[model samples]
Target: MTTGTSKAGMMMELSHDSTLRELTTDQGVLRYHEAGDGQPLLMLHGSGPGVTGWRNFRGNLARFSEHFRCLVLEFPGFGVSDPADGHPMATATDAVGRFLDGLGLHQVDVIGNSMGGFVGTRFALDNPDRVRRLVTIGGMGRNFYSPGPGEGINLLMEFTENPTRERLVQWLYSMVYDPAMVTEELIEERWAQATEPDTLAAARRMYGKAAFAATAAAAARSEEAPLWAMLHGLRAKTLITWGRDDRVSPVDMSIVPMRTIPDVELHLFPNCGHWVMIEQKAAWESTVLAFLTRKDAA
Candidate 1:
């Protein structure tokens, strides 16, 4: 309902693939991109700095739009969306509910990545009736399993300490199987966003919030945590994907759900890192397309 934005606040322009729009909610204004016309597929992004829905989904939107109406959202306190005002920071799970309600989407196919995956999993457990299907990539709500040696985990630490392009480039390399996959343009774009004032401010609030830290930590527990405790509550048929090399979420984390969830399947990609859609572009897109279109689990 409101149109005003600032250099460090709401986004000033739209990406090439979708129309940028704003929606008013009781919590705050949500910034998003929309395209195509079919069953709504709500796309959620990871917690990476400067991660907007567009920036994350721009690659897959074109293909996905062929069969589904894609609504990519930048949650409150991320990207150009307004901060939560007086309300405490909203978890991705809670934010998804409020965000969809603002658009009158009672039900939709939900897809999420990394932190987004964690949020989607929790949402499926809590609001089974609202999610038609659930898909997660390197999802983090579950606990970390037997963490092996080489998942490129130190990359995050290295970047945190230095925050330089070289460090970021190194971190990006850790995200994929091939070093060449991390392009210069991509690095430049992410570096700019990761260092921007709005992104940095939001990161401080989000990473500092107790709720966020608790969820991530709870997910680290294989047993006795709310995340794992509610696994059976997920009613939607679910698909879990992960980069076998994903050091951040750890491929091992997928093991718990494999044993616990009722109707779920896990797909692992070799030579891939945290960003599944990017590292394995063709396979990721085609597999998801098939999954979303398929009527049976087989």
Candidate 2:
């Protein structure tokens, strides 16, 4: 792991190397990207086919690193990190806990995208005192108006079941308000990563038709309450950001957390979709930095 003792030192290191660091935990030897030096900020990525921590948050990391020590954690089963046993979400949630514990970081400010947001919220609820602030970008709430498994998700499931460049392109297009964002290079990169033997297998376990049905059936059988119902138990100061036109996890999903979390705020970005931080980069970063830096209201 590299540390930036001076501004120039930090910039030089970041500019030269994009290498990720590793931390050994009971879950596995988890991988992550670390930058800056200050209050710890744990960043988690979404659980989409071929998605990685770098791909999800690279745009905002530099700016965020300026003020906080940003750690973009690579969840298990995502190809970048060693895969762990169990359902993907359960393994992911456990991986987050193990990551923090491995780093000896008791408390941190967390920003999670989609599935990551769900994991972060679950962690915060289960261990309230360990989170100071929480920020989630879409996919963190229960669907109220929109149907479950939104449009983008259906496309994603299709891609996982039958890996294809065309299907990936379709899903990528659905992720944003503008189709222009899905560039050829992005498609090629995602296709290469998404179709890797083990990675593709992992994706199937999480999003394939049978896997989805099994997950739904398991949830139905479980007696425990869902994450949305546990929102009130999250003690961290929270900020929820969503793309007004999100097709994956629709904007309406934010409603439950908006009404429940004791200390919470929500921002809806126009002309954006599931990838809020990427589609609305500057504005999202500015808003998040302000929230992270601002003193609590007296």
Say what the RMSD of model 2 is.
2.0
Model 1 alpha-carbon miss at residue 68, Å: 0.6
Where does the lowest 10-residue lDDT sum fall in candidate 1? 1-10
Tell me, by lDDT, which candidate is best: 2
Clashes of each: 2, 0
Q: Candidate 2: what lDDT?
A: 0.89
Candidate 2, residues 43-120: lDDT per residue as tens digits?
999987789998998878778888998999998888888987767788889998889899999999999999999999
The segments of candidate 1 whose C-alpha lies over 4 angstroms from its true place after superposition are 1-18, 85-89, 141-145, 148-154, 157-162, 206-224, 296-298
Candidate 1, residue 132: CA error in Å? 1.2
TM-score of structure candidate 1: 0.82
The clash tally of candidate 2 reads 0
Measured against the true structure, the TM-scores of the candidates, in listed sequence, are 0.82, 0.95
- Worst 10-residue lDDT window for candidate 2 reads 10-19
Which candidate leads in TM-score? Answer: 2
